[model samples]
Target: MDILSLAKSVGSRVEAPLTDLRTVTKVLGNPHMPLLLALSKGFVEPVYRAAFLASAASSGVLHALAVRPCDLESLAERLRIADEDRPRLKEWLDMGIRLGDLTKREGCYKLRSLPAKALAQPGNDAIAAALEEVLRFHVPALLNAPRMLREGRRFSLDDQDGLVIARSTRVVQPLVEEAIARTLDRDAPVRLLEVGCGSGAYVRYAAELNPRLSALAVDLQQDVADSAAANMAEWGLTDRVETRQADLRTLDAQPQFDLVTLHNNIYYFPEAERVDALRRAHDLLAPGGRLLLTTSCKGGNIGLEALNLWFTYADFGGPLPQADELVDQLRQAGFDDVEATRIVPGEQFHAFTGTSKRVAYA
Candidate 1:
């Protein structure tokens, strides 16, 4: 079982006092967990409650509770109850408790710990705020997919700029930079290519690390290319990193990069297209060049299969491939060597770091 499954297996038994302190300590100390907790505190829980209510109501369990453990009357009063509804209040309270959202102890109702944690962030409040925007755009957009399919319309991510900003720089860049920094050869000038370089975050970071680094940033959209160029300019790296608008599937550049990276845009391609894209990425490398790819994989509390399926709404056709499959694909594309590593693991997302085989230039 994965780390998350282990946590779930033990999470219930590990609750409070014994585990709560440990859990909070882990959250406080972990680089990723704090951001997650803050997101949970600020946004995830509220949206989840809304989703839960909708899901439960759709399941027809919205209005039935009697003699709840917590004083339903007081809770209802706090939420603004009517005088007439007070007579049947206890029933409503019992129903809510049974529904697993609230806990009732000694005739008092309170939100459950897990749900309470949904909005109980301490430090990383910005993460929560960003997550709210993500869910606001993603959840309904995915849930409404069936209607879209019937209408023969494709879903678009134009409104997900917040998500793009949150993950690209806020999450992926630091991890990528750290991982790459560990593996880079300090004395040699590295030739880098960043595919789908939305805003040149990777290019700028990589350039900062190696002054002799030369990078090419490619994106299909002119706006994205321009944004990347602007970013590179801000870092005074215009001479070192050049931005170009080009499609990865049809890239015509000479194969000469030491590090070729495809950031978060790997999943947008169809299965066949993904294979072709990977093949193209492999073809672009100088013999020993590394092809680094990152994508979300199945992992934690968040349902991976469900999230993958949700992408279908947007006509996103390829679910992330397993690490083994990806490694095999690299070999088939004529890459000399390949290895995969799980760089980051989230409740629902896992990032894979794929390194290509180093070959001698003929």
Candidate 2:
């Protein structure tokens, strides 16, 4: 159906007058038009190169060029792009130019200003690496959607390495930190417990914000736990934060924490297990303590929705409940004053806060 031509025709018709019902009906009948156009524009070349460039950036090719422009031969040698793959690598570098991640001048390729900064800056580097990890770990599962649905088997994200988790934590920690701050009183001393604490970024941020804050972070994977501990040491938060490798289900239910956080990890649990996990978080909170849950709710963002599709098919990861549904679950788990705020409206990110119903008697 010559999708590109159809896309062009649709683009040309957007402003056309369609007062007549027949004309409106005709325009809307071709539902595939918008889908084709979006796929052609958003997913075809740009997304393909974004994945390639992210990989290059992670493997130090972009960072090397960020230091100085280099010819194809020098770049191949420095990055160890195999001898036979040099030509294909050069083509990818050229594609990076077209993708706006690189610039070519006098037979040399260099990182563009934005890419240079992203490769050089630690925060930006982490985000870039995280994006690469998405392409690596998440994209394959998504591509296998047909098989997953037919087989009813889940993809295991538990096998993803600690570096991916660490990088992913850095990517989202800033927004999560802001959300947590908005929900809690920053001045008060608090004990925090974080489940699925990837790299311990949230714990470190909270403890650094208030000297009175201390935290216990739990991760299921030993490697991830080690990485989180190392990050805590790097941030000088080791004294204030302790990390343990343990499954949330197995963790002892103790009312020790003032703020129990479950961030971006809810979908890891199956539908049946989700409520129990929330109840566990509730149990961990002391009297008057709060349980703060942050995740992308179902719908809203297209990219997130697509990822949720893969997660759903995979079994372990599934669609997140809508904000209202989550609020109801918190209430059912015996939480009080349950409220949810969409931190990024129309983008699926939300923070749900609920208070432990236990009250201290005088």
Candidate 3:
């Protein structure tokens, strides 16, 4: 449906305090307003990223401009963009300029301060990579939602070969790390077992935070496990952490860990298996060992709700369970002192905490 028709349909249903049809007329009369609103409501960034990727010299141009402004010819030559590609390159640069990533003056283009800094900083690389992966992989998968739904089938992540999963998980690592730190114990050494530990970000974060903390990071995908191992090694966490490519359900339940974490990966388990997964996590914990679970609950923020829809449509297990339902499951898993707290209230991100019923003697 067209944007105007959609807006009118929505306006008709909303019970606003309006006396007549004039209200809808007044609202939709301003065509630019609706267009601008839609543009601002999450369409802009992906458009910019798509344009950036379409240009062969986009990255090189950004990097070169980070050092110094360059004219079209100089940029083409410096970036090795061929004559045939220069027109497309210029179009991409123009889009970047319009997006405020670059500034153009007197036939030369220069990177804006923030974009320049992002190009120069190593820390921003992960975020950039994540954005690129999302643009390349996730967006395509999302676009296939209608077809998948019609066919009663789901898109699989296997095509991306684990890159999308790894980068996407890493994108939220900081938030998960902060939530874990706030809820988990920090007084003593922690032996953590992180199920579905993508990229080992949380494991490394915890180990770095507590000098005596050690972790066993597990991912079902061998490639992801290998990548996590490399990431741990790069972070100098190899000595304190181990990576295993194994499914959580198949893992030995030895009650060996002081803390077991299931972050953002809970949706991988089918709705029927969720409680069992929680129970298994409980079993893997030492007596009184804490279980920390994090996910966006159903009916949360628009972004999270959209994610839940994609997961459900793609048959990636199931949508995020409701917060209260998750707490009930934790309790049923024989856990004590179960609680659920919002990490970001409106963002729908939350952390669920529970302690195993058995007490530890140290």
Clash list (residue pairs), candidate 2: 154-314
Pairing residues by index, what is the TM-score of model 1?
A: 0.59
Residue-level lDDT of model 2, residues 1-362, one tens digit each, is: 57566565656766886456575466557787678777877878676776866777777887777678899999889888789999998887887776777888999887775654566565476778767767776677677767767887676765456667567546666669888788766788999899999878778777767789988899888888988888888888877888889888889757888999988888888877778888888888889999989887887555566557756765465676778888888898889999888786556788999999999778
User: Clash totals for all models, in order?
Assistant: 12, 1, 0
The digit string of per-residue lDDT tens for model 3 on 159-247 reads 44464567655666667987888866667988999999877878877876788998889998898899899988889888889887989
Candidate 1 lDDT over residue span 1-362, tens digit each:
75433333444454545646766556345566545545655775466565544332222222221223335565565546697787566665454455566666776655554533343333333343335434554566666777877899765656445223433334445566666675555568999888888777777777777878898898876777877777778888888888888888888888888888876676667666666778788878887677767665544334345445545555645665566676676677766646666665433233334455656856
Instruction: List the candidate numbers ranked by lDDT, top first.
Output: 2, 3, 1
Question: Number of the top candidate by lDDT?
Answer: 2
The candidate that wins on TM-score is: 2
Off by over 4 Å in 2: 1-44, 71-108, 112-121, 158-162, 169-174, 344-347
> Whole-model Cα lDDT per candidate?
0.61, 0.78, 0.75
Candidate 1 clashes: the total is: 12
After superposing candidate 3, which stretches have Cα over 4 Å from the reference?
Answer: 1-109, 112-142, 159-161, 170-174, 345-347, 359-362
